[model samples]
Target: MLFFVALLVDGILAGSVYALVALAFVVVYRVSRVINFSLGEWVTFAARLVGTGTHALALPLAGALAFASAGMAALALAFNHVVLHRLIGHPPISLVMVTIGFGAVLQASTVLFFPAGSGAISLPVPSEPIEIGGLFLVPGKLVAAAIAGLGVLIVARVYRTRTGLALRAIADDPQAAMASGIDIDRHVVLTWSMAGVIAVVAGTLSAAVWGGGLSLVLVGLKVFPIVVVGGMDSVAGTVVGALLIGVLESEAAGYLNPVLGAGFSSLAPYLVLLGVLLVRPYGLFGTPGIERI
Candidate 1:
């Protein structure tokens, strides 16, 4: 029972990171109306920047992460202004395809620039275990959760900004917002870059636990079920989904893995995704406006 509780706690903390990324997805999709499939590449690019900054260029870790996020945000702005700007009214497929191409560009650049990528690395923080009663906690996971929580708060604050209000209007109807004198290009470019910050945090957390490598890009796949399970358009729903998925995944890996074997642990989230979609196609908190993942 105690072990089960520990697994639950760990999963919830880990899910906080996924929730952060999911919030990014919600933010981007709500305004842009295009699901950027190249999300993984974005994450890898940010992680590579951090890895290169710290290990290769001898910069401090926090500074490296901050610089990486800032650089990525700039890159996102460039992407929106330079590429997506022209395709503003293009079909969704065209926009998605462009994003895919852009992702490929990002991945290729990471390989070319880094050559030898950052290998497995943990954060430069104390790894001491903290015990509360009989429960023990990992400092790394605690820090990750705190960062995720802070990110959620930041996202909430964004929704109440004047810019956010304009963005919301644009999200409701781009054509109408444009007719009403909203600067669609300016707002989108600004908002799109925010995703870069989220991606950096997600990428960095993954690096601290899993390693900073090209494979870190694939971890983006892990976030899919999260946004899907929670409504992709709902920030609050994403948090609930992340926690639900996180705890279930932890339980499956902790207990079921021993009996059902290794692969099942990794498959648990997708399995839940399938189950949820079968029942709620729009997701737990999603509206019926958009249908399709």
Candidate 2:
């Protein structure tokens, strides 16, 4: 029982990071209706920026994080202005494909610019392990989880503010919002910028957990299941979905991996995702849309 509890705790800690990444996806989708397939690339880019800033530039950890955040926000704005801006009226499929292509470009750029042999980026947090009544926890993971929780709270609070109301209005009816004198383009840019910043924070926390590198980009792909399971348009659902997936993955890895011969934890999320799709296509908290032909 103690072991089970330990695993559950660990899963929740890990889920906090996943929740942040899924929240980033939700933010962009809510505003622009774009899935932002290139989100993983942005995360990878931010992680690389931090790695570069810390190692090559020899800056303090705080300084490196600040630099990465600013750089990512600028890049997001530039991408929005230069590429996304031109494709505003395009179909959703077109937007998704463009983002996929952008992700490919980012992957190539990361390979070309970052050092081929660069190892893990060190964070400033303590490396000690905390043990309590036979349950052990890593300080870094605890800190990351706390930060992620705090971030979610801040985002939730944002939804109550005037700017968030404007954002919600744009999401509900872009045409009506524009008619009301809301600057859709400007708001879209701001949403993307906010997503970029969130991506940086998520990537940094994830890198601290799994070590920094291009591999961290895969975390972006992992977030899809969380978003899908939670409800694409529901921020609160993201938190619940993250925790559910995290716990299931942890339990599966602990109990089933030996029989399944490993890698079960990674596969568990997609399995849940499939089940959610089959049972509730719109997701647990997603509202089904009604269309008249």
Candidate 3:
């Protein structure tokens, strides 16, 4: 029915957005084992930078996007090298708290320097929505989703290559990986770099769909549920989780509106996330690793 179709579209869009952000979280966690509470701020930062460059500075869209991405990448590198690297070997809880504190500092700084209040900003990408059989699909969302999917493939391929294998080994055991001649510091830095790129991708797509500025800041938190549903360690699970959550949420909003109160649909992903965590704490594809007696 038409109702079902609408729901499907909404869910896909939501899921795609979550998946892209979640990809960054999973990547960072795999490499550093640090849960970045500020991941969403990076998306917001990139979006605002691109938006401000294009709208305020009058740069071309391509130039704006590129400059914003580069700036974010640089910041990511700085965080890894200057901040996080020094905190290694600290207590896990202490390290996590530090990152959370780091995120707060970044958020405050963003407000002070940028001073751009939250509102939607248009993306630099094309604006024409796609239509199929009379239903309109947001072209920006579709394009972003496609790009994220392609990125997963490319990233996977990289994981199989020598450098990527080394990264994985480092993730599995830092001391052993270093003993085997893998550069742990470099791998960690590289992981942050890769995550920065993905965050830029997510930020770009988000600005296209939802505009830019402070509105995009919370995208990092939005990724939590997606990564939770998708096994944190499984790339394929991320893709699957995105699609499922996206479509389901969309459809729920459309069809269940009459039965449930307004805004109920928006809660679908979190509900699913909670349910999954309570039921399968390791996540859908996450393994239950054990220690020897």
lDDT tens per residue, model 2, 136-197: 89989999999999999888888779888889999889889999999988888888888888
Question: Which 10 consecutive positions of candidate 3 have the poorest summed lDDT?
Answer: 115-124
lDDT of 3 at 67: 76
* lDDT per residue (tens digit) for residues 1-293 in model 1: 99989999989987888788677677888788778878888888888888878888788888888888899899888888788879966888999899889889988988888756574446767888899879988888888789888998898888889988888888778889999999987887777888888888888887776677888776676667887788877778889898888888888999999899987878999998898888886788877666588
lDDT of 3: 0.75
Q: Which candidate ranks first by TM-score, i.e. highest? A: 2
Minimum summed lDDT over a 10-residue window in model 1 is located at 115-124
Model 2 alpha-carbon miss at residue 200, Å: 0.9
Best model per lDDT: 2
Residue 141 miss distance in model 3 (angstroms): 2.4
lDDT per residue for candidate 3 within 104-196, as digits (tens), equals 877777787774643245544567767788788776677777776677778778889999889778777888998998887778778888888
Check candidate 1 and list the clashing pairs: none
Question: Better model by lDDT, 1 or 2?
Answer: 2
Q: Candidate 2 at 28: error in angstroms?
A: 0.7
The positional error of residue 81 in candidate 3, measured at the CA in angstroms, is 2.4
**Candidates' lDDT values, in order?**
0.82, 0.85, 0.75
Candidate 2 at residue 193, lDDT? Answer: 82
